[model samples]
Target: LKPLGFEGGPELVCQSLAEGPFGIESQADVDSVAMPLRKLVEGDNSSAAFVIACYSDPGLQVCREGTDRPVFGIAECGVLTALARAETFGVIAIAQRSIPRHMRYLRQMGLTERLAGERPLNMSVAET
Candidate 1:
């Protein structure tokens, strides 16, 4: 961010939910954190933008709807960045099971056609 010419670098805000899963490996885990994430975004008043770092982008839409500030999803940003530099792009996922979910998300974004492929590292989020 500093290299991009912002006076001060981006701030990092990390939150943990009382009952959320240790790792968001499934859709159920993503669903479990959505409302909590949205609440976090809504409660924030200082940040100029919010970036959800999760690959599944849990609560991205809800957070955007709850706040006036810009909201970005890491997955969305990565994909868009790749698209800007190439004709197509591939995704490196944490697990094989996650590929299907990512594909669904790409389809939702109407970017499936631009996807070269997706491969998994067969690792857990914590391991990665």
Candidate 2:
């Protein structure tokens, strides 16, 4: 993000939630971080947009509800962008347990038809 922000590009700020599940493999994992994510988003007064960097996009709606600024979930953003330019798309997940959650979101967004497949690396954040 830093490298891409150079040469007068929009400044990007990245932050991690200090108190939440370190790795998200299930709904519980995503849920555990909701409050912390909301608090972080509400506290930050610097940026005009907020991005949930995690692939699982924990607390995306909560963050959006708390602010008028743009809120982006990387997974949703990537999927939407890919679908705009391609017929079908796939995702490489960090674990098999994450596939169901990912699929759920795709289904919720009515994008399951556009998804080609999802493959998991079966690795944790530390391993990656």
Local distance difference test, each candidate: 0.86, 0.87
Alpha carbon lDDT at 111, candidate 1: 99
TM-scores of the candidates in the order shown: 0.84, 0.90
lDDT of 2 by residue, 1-128 (tens): 86677686788877877787778888998999988898888988888888899988899999999888999999989998998999999898888888889999999999999888787776545654
Please write out the lDDT profile of model 1 over residues 26-113, one tens digit for every residue: 8888899999988888888898898888899989999999998999999999999999999999888887877888888999999999
* Candidate 1 colliding pairs: none
What would the TM-score be for candidate 2 when compared with the true structure?
0.90
